[model samples]
Target: MSKETETMKHNAEVAQFRFALIAPVIQGLFPDASATAYYKRVSAAPLMLPEGTSVKYSYKTLENGNPCTAPEGLIH
Candidate 1:
């Protein structure tokens, strides 16, 4: 495969792995929640971050699938 194709494949694999890691948690939190709705809510929620910081923020998924800023760089 070409380098670009290989890179794309790797990215796709990583995305799938990330989804796998989070899917169970999302399911457990919102047993009846639709994936589309859950993602929409998550995307709309404000990320908790330090003021005046332009850092890349990480989020923790709440019981309702809401995304909250992780504390101390720890995933909730």
Candidate 2:
């Protein structure tokens, strides 16, 4: 649609890429961790890393699920 909207989307995409790049770096410091494990830890860190860093994980979610875990939770 508009230039402003397009710019915003581009910026968001860039931020996601940057986060993904940093994720592995942060995960590498851990001992014998899987990629998914690294992603999980990285996603949680952004939750408290100031506004900009936190924005990178705005839509992040864990893949862990259960048949009886949070039957009424919206995220489940």
Candidate 3:
């Protein structure tokens, strides 16, 4: 791919990854909201993290036998 094309591809991947990260949270928080409204609400909410900390998501099995991704954090 050309340099510009490569950059666009990477940007699209990043956007999709970010959406995946937030999708479950948005759905849980706004179960009855439309997609457009959910996006609006989530975008307007404040996401605060402590200094030297990062968020990470991990997939694990729940007691009910369903797999889920839970967000965790690492603090430096």
Candidate 4:
């Protein structure tokens, strides 16, 4: 694949991984009392990516997922 194609492929994989990580929060699948606690708990933990690397998502990234479930009083 071309360099640009490779980059796009990686980015698409990353986006899918991110959505999988935050799917519950976005879909209200978890039973957290509020979004804040959920974000805090999740942000506190490390996430493993497809490349076998570990990372932690920032509050802003998680908050920006679903427009309906963000800011206001959910995340800072």
TM-score of each candidate? 0.38, 0.34, 0.37, 0.63
Best prediction by TM-score: 4
Error of 1 at 2 (Å): 0.7
Encode model 3's per-residue lDDT on 34-69: one tens digit a residue.
544444444454432333235333321111111233
Candidate 4's residue-wise lDDT over 1-76, tens digit each? Answer: 9999999998888778767656787788867787766767777878788778998877656766645765443222
List, residue by residue over 1-76, the lDDT tens digit for candidate 1.
9999988887776555445534654456644355545544544545433233333223333323323322322232
Top-lDDT candidate index: 4
Kindly provide the TM-score of model 4 when superposed on the true structure, using C-alpha atoms. Answer: 0.63
By TM-score, the better pick of 1 and 2 is: 1
The 0-to-1 C-alpha lDDT of every candidate, in the order given, reads 0.45, 0.45, 0.42, 0.71
Task: List the candidate 4 regions with Cα displacement exceeding 4 Å.
Answer: 51-53, 70-76
- Which segments of model 2 are wrong by more than 4 Å? 27-76
lDDT of 2 by residue, 1-76 (tens): 8999988887777656554444443445533255455546655654533234554342223322211222332123
RMSD of 3: 14.3
lDDT of 4 at 69: 65
Candidate 1: segments with Cα more than 4 A from true spot: 29-76
Which pairs of residues have clashing backbones in candidate 4?
none
Question: lDDT score, residue 39, model 1?
Answer: 44
Q: Model 4 residue 65 lDDT?
A: 63
Least accurate 10 contiguous residues by lDDT in model 1: 67-76
| Residue pair clashes in candidate 3 | none
Off-target runs (Cα >4 Å) in candidate 3 are: 29-76
